[model samples]
Target: MKKLIIVFGIIALTLVSCKNGDENNADKKTAVRKKVPVRKEPKNVSYTLESAKEWLKKNKSKQNLKISLAVNRTDKENFAKMDSVIIPTDLSGDIVFYLPFPLQVDFLQNVDKIILFSYPTQAFAVYENGILIRTGPTNMGKAKDPTPTGLFFTNWKAEETTSTFNDEWELKWNFNIENKKGVGFHQYELPGYPASHSCMRLQEKDAKFLYEWADQWVLADDENVKFKGTPVVVFGSYDFDAPKPWLQLIKNPKALAIPESEIKEIIMPYLSTILKEQEKRKKT
Candidate 1:
């Protein structure tokens, strides 16, 4: 009987020890969860047409005069109805947009000449050795036939060219980027939207300037063209269904300017290639 009693006592003690250990483990787990920090997202800023107009009017003199350029491109007749469109914010919480607002041009410098086009902003900028010499608005390919994104060298140019798709369409100051598909930049209509047929449509003056400024691909005596011309980087996407992003400038003028760090990130991918092309150009 005494032996039986002692065995029961040992089993009971073992059970009690295991229960205490389990409780200690649970407490540790809870403590660890409490110590973990929670990540908080940025606060969303909202806007309305009346609010944007009011903001624009109040700070007219304090900001850059061209800050309103993006919104100005929008159809004023129907702009007020687009008040619900949200202004985008970047990873750093700064307003992210592209308009003719002076581009923060400190990122790229190696190339002799470069053309950077942003779809979101519908804007193109020309740079020489890192300085932003000129910027203008553009109407890119429509949603059905979007302009291709990535690095491309200028292929050839013409003072005037007939559209490959429709001979009736005439393109003035046509600078071809993709010759095979009839894709190029030329002076065309801009209804403040992406309405092109897979080509970039620039203002007449801008198209003329680029035609005269950018070098065309070199051709050998046999007439085979080499990939030797100015580098053009067409990046970013445009949301056609949404109102123009610059309309948000009425809410925050600074939103039209992207942070330079973001610009650096965009150009970093192409820096090595740009350097190689710069070297090749120098030799030629």
Candidate 2:
């Protein structure tokens, strides 16, 4: 009887030891499963004075570097003060990346050509078949003489024309949108802010490019337009009291990221009218 009782005790001890070992193994497996690598999110790079200098040095040899720098600076005067200028990190990239305009707009796919002048951003973008083709800086109306905002068609163009506001001021590559208001876009001085006499100002290169690109209205009579030319949408209000909008880019890289939805919204109101005119042009 004593031997049988001893054997039972030993068996019970072995079973408990095996159970403890199994529990330890399970704990080890749990720890192994927890040692996984995690993915990290990308951080946005901020612009700095040093980076701007480096960028300038790198692109100094570029042909359009001066114009690119001027546009980034928001004016020729600001560009002159390059030491203090804060520019986008991707300054060396395509101009589209820095400008506040979508690369592609779905709604504009059917439209042949359109031009947009953003008052607040002080920029102009040209879209051909919903794809952004070109963009550049613009110095628009002064606070006292603000550029009129609305839909207008290109009326007439001249390689060089005198400003109606001031005959002495010779405007180059001029394209008139509003004959009554004498409002047009042409090559003029960009003081780095809105200093125009209620007219849109562009760099000489941009002015010449647009001169050749935009079409003039087909006039049936002296005052009557038979077929309208390219559509021009001038929208938004500038805050003269506020500092330059591009300055905010120093803090946020996406400060000027104009949302695709916003572009769609802006165009929706005039989409029908633009399409009707486009169809009329096609027929002619």
Candidate 3:
């Protein structure tokens, strides 16, 4: 009996030692540590002030872009369109048009004096010897500040401009006017009829040759013709004699001679003031 009790006591002692070790292991598991994550750094972009300025300068430029158009001012709806009729200088010498209030084509009839139509309306007129040659729709400034309605003379022209005006400045044939800094005629790209600040606008090609036309007569170096205080009559009404002036024949493919009754009349060798200048040049 003694031996059996001793054995039971040993076994109980062994069980207690195992239970203590198990509790110690449970505590260690509950106190386990955690790992931390690593972070990455960001990089910065750099540029020079001069380089930035150069980029902006290239992007924001206030330049006057050039454009060409074909227009007919007689029809308010057809002011600046290129549909059917185009009077090219090479074809008939009337392809280009100078839009002074309401003109659509820049024409070179090779005539003596040129006539502008559509004084203040979209539709203007062009005639040669009492015959209606062409018409189109155009836009002019407000009537309060309208383009004059009269027989005006071609006086000036410019192919390119360096001005900052909100207009197509580099123009062809800036015609004679009472005002120069404020008024004249040239080629313009109008958004619609009556789309000018104060000058006459026309198509680029028309304006190009028109400038040459006016320069032939008025520019001092080539000043061969003169019409001081030239009559710019905008009757707005078409008359046989008034509409078909003799000067318009310069465009005739067959070129009918200028009869005395029409132009270069009676004064035999009747030199205009410009004639004296020509004679002096010949003697030189």
- Which candidate ranks first by TM-score, i.e. highest? 2
Per residue, candidate 3 scores C-alpha lDDT tens digits across 1-284 of 00001111122111000000111122222221222223221132111122222333343321101101222232212322323322212221222222222121112111222334343233334433222244333344443455555334443333444234423244343443433223555555544445554455554444444455433223323323333322222334222224221113234322212222322221112223322333333353
Alpha-carbon deviation at 241 in model 2, angstroms:
0.7
Best by lDDT: 2
Off by over 4 Å in 2: 1-46, 49-59, 63-70, 73-78, 81-83
Weakest ten-residue segment in model 1 by summed lDDT: 13-22
Error of 2 at 200 (Å): 0.9
Models, CA RMSD each: 26.1, 30.3, 45.1
Arranged by TM-score, best first: 2, 1, 3
C-alpha lDDT values of all predictions: 0.58, 0.67, 0.31
lDDT of 2 by residue, 1-284 (tens): 00001111122111000000111222221111221223222243345444445555666555345535544534444555555555544444555666678877766666778999998889999988777888888988888888888888886666765544455677788777776556778887776778887778888888899889998888776546788888998989999999887778777767877776787777777877776777788787
Compose the digit string of candidate 1's lDDT tens values, residues 1-284: 00001111122111000000111222221111112123333365333343444444454442222323233343322223333323223222221233442333444544568888888878788877555666677778888888888777886566865554565677788776664455678887666668787778776778899999998776653345444678888888987888766665656755656455665667777766765666666677
Which stretches of candidate 3 lie above 4 Å from their native place? Answer: 1-111, 124-137, 167-173, 215-232, 235-284
Give the least accurate 10-residue stretch of model 3, judged by summed lDDT.
13-22
CA lDDT, candidate 2, residue 270: 80
